[model samples]
Target: MSRKNRHEEHEEHADESWLLPYSDLMTLLLALFIVLYAASSVNISKLEELSKAFDNAFSSGISILDKSALIEAEDEQNKSQKQRHEEIGIRTQQEKLMAQEQEDLEKLKKELDQYIDKNGLVTQLETQLNQSQLMITIRDNALFASGSADVKPTAQKLAVAIGLMLQKYPDYEVLVSGHTDDHPISTSEFANNWELSSQRALNFMEVLLQNQAFDPKKFSFIGYGEYRPVDTNDTEAGRAKNRRVEVSILRKYTDSSATNTVLSAISDEANSAPSTTTSN
Candidate 1:
């Protein structure tokens, strides 16, 4: 009876040994499910970190998760570099266009200057190239009679000449502005300096439009009246300077320093060149 009891206890011990292996198998399956859930939810960067941890712990080689993260990072970097290169190319093209525009304006200025010299109109007309615009200033007396807005019949020829010269650059925006001396005036045709100045600018602009080549949409006109004077109204000479009409060719791109450099170069060339006029 004692021997049989010992045998029964041994059998029970051996059966429990099988249970230990079964419990271990269940634990391993639970761990695999948890790993699968984490992988599905984690981002690539986090997955790479997890892969590194697994590699260290198990002495495994490079994981597929790490390789995928590295490839994505490299693709992002390449896309960023491509975007930078495209922006640089666009900037370079814009710069080239601006340079071409500046060259065209400079050529136009030279042609107009030569015409002014040839006609001996320097006393009545002046041209200035600046950062904002290329301005052509004409004495009001050259265009209109005293207190009158009508352009003088002889002076219409000058307007025609200027209009023809402007035809070369049809794309530029043109502004015609009229200014007057501070001397107050009330007449049958004009109630004040404002009306007089406005009519003068309008009439002058009309003459400029006679050349069918100009785009009327690109032209604008304004009257400054007695205000916006360039010279003091105290003296006759100053008043003469103050009463003027300005035709401004507006610039598409304005840079003061770059314009100054261009102006300096133009001035140097003018000073060195012979004082001779050539017909356009």
Candidate 2:
């Protein structure tokens, strides 16, 4: 009787067998999730090695994660090839545009040359075509009065004619630049060569812009005064040559080596050509 009472008094032990396997299952789930996250962001070279690890861990020849990695790599390659093709297309289009620009400029130069020759205006105007731009250099006396920035009444027709020609190239940027001889001048009406040159360019540009067909935004003017000169300022004839107005139709695209070659050819032609203006 005493032994039976002692056995009943002994505490009941709880079942602890379920915990070990449950903990192991949670650990495995965490590792799987970690591997999936890494696979998404990893480099292709590293992801291949990780795909092998996934196969080893799952005891399979190829896991779902490995298939995902293959899909990602294929997508990246396709994107790269597409981008390269787009770049090639853009470059080809640019080349075509430049070729057309050159052809148009050449045609315009010939037309202007014909007009100058037919009108007996070769002595007052000249044109040069190069890779950089098509330049029209006009003698100052042809457009402006002595010691004045105002355009002459007779020159209005010339301006209107040039404006008509420029209407075809609405996209080109036209730069009208004024240059002056080194002789100094200061007066109530005019201060110096800078003011004189600037006014000359502005006034002429206004005349060109009066034509509604020409876009005002595509035109600009500047004054170089006596700083930029094509001829020497030491002699009267040279000074007359130096004081001139130039209109340059700028190039949209430029390649330095190609431009240099074209410029050299133009220079050779210019040196061989006869003088367009005589000394005042």
Candidate 3:
């Protein structure tokens, strides 16, 4: 009877094998939840520490979480480096383009100066290269008679020459502006200096457009009359200087700080230079 009672007691004890598997499943679930929380937090250092802890606890060499985090960090670093390289490349290209443009403008200015010197037109024509534009200034007497809007027949060759030089740079914008002395005019052809200046600028621009290479859309004409004079209108010589035409090739790319510096230098030079009185 005692042996039978002991056997019954052993049978009454619950099966403990299932408890081991259940506890293992609970542990696995907890690990999964921890992994999810770490990944959502985006704290790489904390994630690496957790991976190391999990690796040591499981006795595994390296955890999948660690490998995945390392790969993600490497990818982010590569993307950042690529973006920086692209930005540098773009800036380099822009600098190259700006340098080339400067060279072309300088060359053109040199050619124009040569032409002026060769033709003995230094007294009638002058060229100035500034940060904003390349300006070609011509005395009114070179292109027209006194108070006349018509371009002289002989001066048409000069216009043709300038147009030929400009053909090398088709992309630049050109402005033809006319200025006049303060003397009033009431001729049958022109009511005032404004009308005469406008007609003169239009006629000069028309001659320039005769070249087939020139795009008329890129050219503009304006007349300042006596409003925007380079010299005084009080004296005959100064008035002669004021009565002029200007052809300006506008710059496509300009640095504002550099332009200000150049302008200041030019003003200082003009103030120091000797003033020579020349008549038209």
Candidate 4:
């Protein structure tokens, strides 16, 4: 009775024991599926971060293909971050290039001012470096006699000086704009002040370009007449201020580019340059 009982017990135990290992395997598979579902629902950035954490934790000196998928996921995230950094770097470089161009223009403006003061050209021509362009304003009386479009000999000399100064800098567009006082012009050569002012500006531009040293590609002329006056036409003083010609040097970069795109436009010359002028 004892022998039969022991043998039966051993056979039952052998068959039933196999269920323990099978149940353990099934439980592990269920847990793995649950983990996969959770990971799939996570945001990409956080998923990448979590994968990296797993890589550091499970790095063993064995050939396990288990880490390959996680490593690939982390690598993709790293690549995306690196691309963003590179884009930012390119933008920064472009901004720096624009800033340097602005600085160079400011330096040129200061030189022009010194030339104006040294040659006693004040009351005749004044300089201004603004956001869009560098402007050199010349009073009409200095360039032409009243009711005349012909540029005076003194004005020709002034143009030559300014033209020579411009040659020192890189090629840039030069706009020679003519403006005039509100007074009506009834002259033999012109019908209205507009025609007279425009002719004067064109004549001045011609004088400046005569040297051949000036690049024709960089020059343009426009006449605003009395319409674009700097001052009111109601008074003699206002008319005097309004009757002028302006030579504007167009900058490659605009004000918005420097102020918004670049780090800052803190030009030493711009800061120190005179903000306003007065005629005696």
Report the number of the highest-lDDT candidate.
3
Question: lDDT of all the models against the reference?
Answer: 0.81, 0.81, 0.83, 0.75
lDDT of 2 by residue, 1-280 (tens): 9888777666455567899999999999999999999877748898799988887778956567887999999999999999999999988998898899988899889888998999999989999988788999998999998888999997878999988888888888787888888887776776767667778988999999999998888787777677678999889888988888988887776565754543353344324422221111
> Clashing pairs in model 4?
none
Off by over 4 Å in 3: 1-85, 256-280
| Model 4, global lDDT | 0.75
Q: Per-residue lDDT tens digits of candidate 4, residues 162-274?
A: 88888776477777877787666565577666567668878999998987877887777766667666778889889899989988787775675643321222132113422
Provide C-alpha RMSD values for all models, in order: 16.3, 17.6, 15.1, 17.3
lDDT of 3 by residue, 92-144 (tens): 98888778888999999999999999999999999998877889999999999
Residues 1-280 of candidate 1 have per-residue lDDT tens digits of 9999999989887745688889999999999999999878858898899988988756666567877899999999999999999999988987897787789888888989999899888999999987778899999888888888889997899999999888999988787888888887766677777667767888999999999999999887767677678988889998899888989887776675653443353245324422321110
Higher lDDT: candidate 3 or 4? 3
- Which scores higher on TM-score, 2 or 3? 2
Error of 2 at 87 (Å): 1.1
Candidate 4 versus the native: TM-score? Answer: 0.60
Show the lowest summed lDDT stretch of 10 residues, model 2.
271-280
Model 3 poorest ten-residue lDDT run: 271-280
